[model samples]
Target: MTFLAVARLGRYTAAAEVLGLNHSTVSRRIAMLDASMGGRTLVRTAGGWEITDLGRRAMAAAESIEASLRALGEQAGGDPVQGMVRVAAPEAFTSAFLVPAVARLHRAHPGLAVELLAATQRVRQNRSGVDLEIVVGRPQVHRAYATPVCDYSLRLYATADYLARAGEPRTVDELAQHPLIYYVESSLQVDDLDRAVQRLPASPPSIRSTSVFAHVEATAAGAGIGVLPDFLAEHDQRLVAVLPDDYAHPLSYWAVVRDGPRSTAVAATLNALDEHVRSVGVG
Candidate 1:
């Protein structure tokens, strides 16, 4: 009961309240859980508790046990393989790709459920309980599995109004005066990116964003000149290209996943992602 409550409520005190137990009792039960696993499973936080690495593993174990138990109940009826797949992806990815795929997945697999978590930060490995993560940049080949999804073409764009007001830039040198919106890059050095953008003779962007989607939306709203992925920019007639199509930039996108329990279901999902790659055409 304490375990279920803690997992449900995400805090010891709240779990204690839900279980109708004293706070100390809840504490003891959790400590027992730690002892059962031979280590601490969670760290106490001022606002709540964070599951430790071991706690994450223990949680998976508990889930597997529950699944086995449910399998027994399912055996009496017709049980298609059923489970919840947790996916971690950027807000843009959720909006652009994964969310649209959900409806078809549901129709194809009536019993399987997908839990999509929108994250502004880069998705960590399975240790963070994210079964799959889609990232925009170079694929991590070292991980259990990574597939290049698309080139994710990036180019300068501005709203029709913003461009009309500022006037279209005819030469690379003219870019210095206009307000531009850029992404504040990380992991990858911005110097190389800056050098490339400098080739266009642009003044630095007035507004910078970490989110590609945010940059796209802001540019469409006449915030400033910014880059947008082909998938996004192609759909919006309000946004126009600032640079020629031949302009060169470096970046890519990938879908990453950890090794799941060997199964046809997991393999099929990977294959599906691979198949989707071809459909993501170039800019």
Candidate 2:
């Protein structure tokens, strides 16, 4: 189990947190597993831990055992939706949708715990640690299921003061004159966002950040015209849409889960998230 946790999470500290054990204990167990297996299973890398061929075989066997145990528990009527459900998602959606969904789930299942990893990256092909992932575009995974959660729009926004100081651009060509605030091009991972940025007219002077929240704040503070999600920017009274109808990028949020029988906790979490997204339509 310790080996499985380590392999899934890729970091000793993260595995320890999930397993509710100290860092030393987790390390010792991995060492023992290596000794018993007669080969190195995992190696530390710049990105994280990389699993070896031997480790892949071990993981496959361990997963089968785990599935059998879960089936046995269900057969004995011991299936209860209570435990940890880890999720990886974008920061904006985590605050706008997931936090409230988890809160509601907690009220019904007090024994349930959730760990949310705020990230803005593509869905990893090897989804080891997280039970669920919410991404900006439709994900293509070999062994996973994806469902569209909601559609949102990204449009040009600016503060009234900024617009007054630098006249608003009436056409896409004219946008070149004003400064823009958006994600740093080099750090961006999602293709949908990249395409959106590519479609926009080039603006020389701009503020780039890795965070959408920062984009909203800078635009509100009269930094520059920001391409921001409507769900996030529409609520801020300080921001005014620049070209509501003329310029908009439509995007969908998708929920992804591993392709197999889900644990009770995972099922509950996914259901709760779906319900919340439906209740509050984004687009």
Candidate 3:
């Protein structure tokens, strides 16, 4: 189990946490395994450990065994409807939108538990840690099952107080005269966001951050104008939309599941998300 965890997460500390072992223990076990095989299974790197060719073969065999065990456990049912479902998505969406939707899903199915990995890092379909992913743009995994789950709009916003103080700028060119807040250039992961950046005025923003939450907070503090997702700012009375219809950037959210026989629980979770998108106005 320790080896499997390490192989799956590719990080000793993460594997240790999942397996309830010390970091040193996880490393020691891997070292022991390598010594027993009289070959290096994983090569240590500054970032993390990478599997050797032999380790890849061994991991493949281990995965097959794990799959077999899972199949045997599922013999009593078609697919599991109760258990943990790990979903990865951007932090902004998780806090602003998905939290309430997932809460509803949990209320309907009390036995199901959802593990949310809310971060900027993109989760891959082949990654063993996550069961589903809500991707911002097109997923790179071609073989994975992917579909557009929802559409949301982003528009310029400023605090009501800020607008009152600075005066509202009606057009893009007028908006440029005021201070702005935006994402850092290097941190942009979505192609569509780059286009949005292109639409910005030639003036540089007064504030920049890699986190969407920061952008929202800074904008709300009357620091500068910010482009934020409608779902996040729409409910906050403090924020007023700036040229919403004219400058709104349309974006689609995609749900991706690894290519394989999905469990009943996963199917239900996907269904719930689809329903939420349709029924609940995300924006």
For candidate 1, write residues 1-283 as lDDT tens digits: 4564465344666556544688899889888998999998877665356567887787677667756765775688744434545566667667776665654666777776667777645434323444466775654343356766666655778887887888887765677778777666443233433444556554554777777677777888898777566667867898777766555465555667654323233444545555554555431
Each model's RMSD to truth, in Å? 6.2, 3.6, 4.6
Better of 1 and 2 by lDDT: 2
Clash pairs of candidate 3? Answer: none
TM-score, each model?
0.63, 0.80, 0.71
List runs of model 1 lying over 4 Å from the truth.
1-81, 120-126, 141-143, 185-205, 260-268, 275-283
Quote the positional error of residue 262 for candidate 1 in Å: 3.1
For candidate 1, give the lDDT of residue 62: 69
By TM-score, the best candidate is: 2
lDDT of 2 by residue, 118-221 (tens): 98889877645687889999988766778888999889999999999999888877888888899999999999998886777888788899998999989998
Q: For each of the candidates, give the backbone clash count.
A: 1, 0, 0
Q: Write the per-residue lDDT of candidate 3 for residues 132-183, one digit (tens) a residue.
A: 7887766677446888777787789999899989889888888778887877
Worst-scoring 10-residue span by lDDT in model 3: 119-128
